[model samples]
Target: MVERCKDAGITILPSAGPVAEMFNGKKIASSTRARDLKEGQYPAAVYVPRADTVERFLAPQSTSATAPSRAPHAILI
Candidate 1:
């Protein structure tokens, strides 16, 4: 999935907070959704990444290189 995103010129920046807390403390750090998932408080842990925060990074991309690809649409988890 990540490779496919890269191929489509969509760079992925994953959150390492979960992993870092898990490994450092030997416990899965709880997030609202993680805890909700555990307790069945919701069907799924849905998240929409804030692309606006990374606007500066995408701003410099060349038009041709960054044109949206049609093969695959965006996926969020």
Candidate 2:
């Protein structure tokens, strides 16, 4: 996935959180110990893939020229 993103000119920033350092590569998993945020924290970060990259990854074998894309779901901290 990292190689594919790089090939498509997508930049993957460092994963954030306590165990983030363990994932040296572009992909990582995250979890929260708290049930939810304290209250004031906004969406500090969001992961949105590039349109073309999403299209390519999702519709590689698609014969149709168009693929419907929707806004990515946002996760609150």
RMSD after CA superposition, every candidate? 13.6, 14.3
- Per-residue lDDT of model 1, residues 1-77, tens digit only: 12224544433333333321233344323332211111124243323233322232223322243355431344221
How would you encode candidate 2's per-residue C-alpha lDDT over 1-77 as one tens digit per residue? 12123332333343343332112353333332211111124432334323212232232332342323312332211
Clashing pairs in 2: none
**Worst 10-residue stretch by lDDT in candidate 1?**
31-40
Clashing pairs in 1: none
**Top model by TM-score, which number?**
2
lDDT of each: 0.30, 0.29
Residue 19 Cα positional deviation in candidate 1, in Å, after optimal superposition: 11
